[model samples]
Target: MMWGSSEEYKAMFVEETNFYNRIILGWFLPPMMWENLPHFFQTWLRNYIGGVFLYLVSGFLWCFVIYYWKRNLYIPKDCIPTRKAMLMQICVAMKAMPWYTLLPTFSEYVIESGGTRCFPRINDIGVPAYVGYLLIYLLIVEFGIYWAHRELHDIKPLYKYLHSIHHIYNKQNTLSPFAGLAFHPLDGILQAIPHFFALFVVPIHFTTHIALIFLEALWTANIHDCIHGKIWPIMGAGYHTIHHTTYRHNYGHYTLLMDWMFGTLRDPTVDNDEPKKVC
Candidate 1:
């Protein structure tokens, strides 16, 4: 058995996420409120409520450190987003937060219900094989996300209805870490679908998968901050800033390899001579 028995392993997701759930369950909510709701809704709420604090805490802390204490060092003159823009970013993200979280919550339910290929322990596959599977899983996710993100632009209605919400902060003057997740609800979830897609095809560790989903919150905050890390392979804020500006190049997510492969890559070091394509 994965844990002592099927029953024990099945409860693992709840056990892992419950500390955050207790914030809702222990204080403003009673057990009765949760017991009465559908299981899917309950899990989604746990993720959504916990995610609100996670997004705000990490986003604000990054803002305080990079946008506030060291403003001149990170942001250029006139590039600092106005307070109104910051509030708009936060509001857009808050509105989409629930749907952004729902996919992973559903993935966890599928895994716990014995519907995915995910294993609960590294030892189940041994250290060597665990590392191999992890590398493969990461690559699949990177490849899948690049295409998912790019297609969101290439497709007409998808770009017009969903992706355009995020493109609002297309300039450095308008972009901030808060703009990281200021995507339309469906738009964000569609980009994140690759994470769930990896589960059925790869031997990902169950807990590790969930942790990575949460980590993306912090990461999106990084890439949208507009301060390039200048590391090759990794698609930093500089390249992402160009993506917002031109809407035609640098559609890769996480890595530049896909952009390089598909001929959409642009170097921020060079003046953007590429035509700004419109839908």
Candidate 2:
């Protein structure tokens, strides 16, 4: 099995003292406090509490950056949500918290067969192999999310009943980082299926798994933040803002690869030349 040892697996979840890793991990659990707990308790806290914390912090950071630091520089003034809509988005996200917490536990059960290799540590495999696994995992998630997201729009019943809740923020001004998870519970679950499924099909390192989860949170916020611009082929707020404006296009999560391949990719640059349309 490409997955490493139990000891190596456990090491990835343990608290670290390095400043960079500590800062990243600290966003989930306080080093001075939670790190002192027993390894079992620490690991449990990191998985459950940390997962929720990452979600909240990622949303808040994007909100803070756009609302405070960048002001109207990066994000268009028209695209900024009203305080009421922002508050409502937060309320909807809070309702999804239980689902977020349960996701990890559900994933554990799904991938737990025999000695389970879903949580390999960094040293368990060579760097090249580790990077390759991450790339594969991302491709798998992208393919899954593209079709699921596209169908969420194509299927009228699913769109009206489930996906439509997300479209409430369809226009730019109503969009926010919190709006990313403001989806109906069923809609959120469908988009997340690939993450869990990958655990069974791929030899993912536990650290990479956690990192991907964090990136998903960050990217979700980035897409909804309304900061217009393309990061090359990688979809950003510009790409997603267009999706909100024109519901029929740009359904891929992180990249336009699937959208381009499937003919769903609309040219966002044309809209960029036009005057800003704020909600």
RMSD of each: 3.7, 4.6
Question: Per-residue lDDT for 74-192 in model 1, tens only?
Answer: 77656777878889999999999978988888897788776777877787789999899888888888888888898899998999999989998877667888998899999998888
Which consecutive 10 residues in model 2 have the weakest lDDT in total? Answer: 12-21
Task: Evaluate residue 41 in candidate 2 and report its C-alpha lDDT on the 0 to 100 scale.
Answer: 43
TM-score of each: 0.88, 0.80
Worst 10 residues of 1 by lDDT: 270-279
**Model 1 local distance difference test score:** 0.81
Tens digits of per-residue lDDT, candidate 2, 168-216, equal 9977678988887887777887888888777767778765665676567
**Model 1 stretches with alpha carbons more than 4 Å out:** 1-39, 271-279
What's model 2's TM-score? Answer: 0.80
- Judged by lDDT against the true structure, how good is candidate 2? 0.71
Q: What is the lDDT of residue 228 in candidate 2?
A: 65
* Cα shift from native, residue 95, model 2 (Å): 0.4
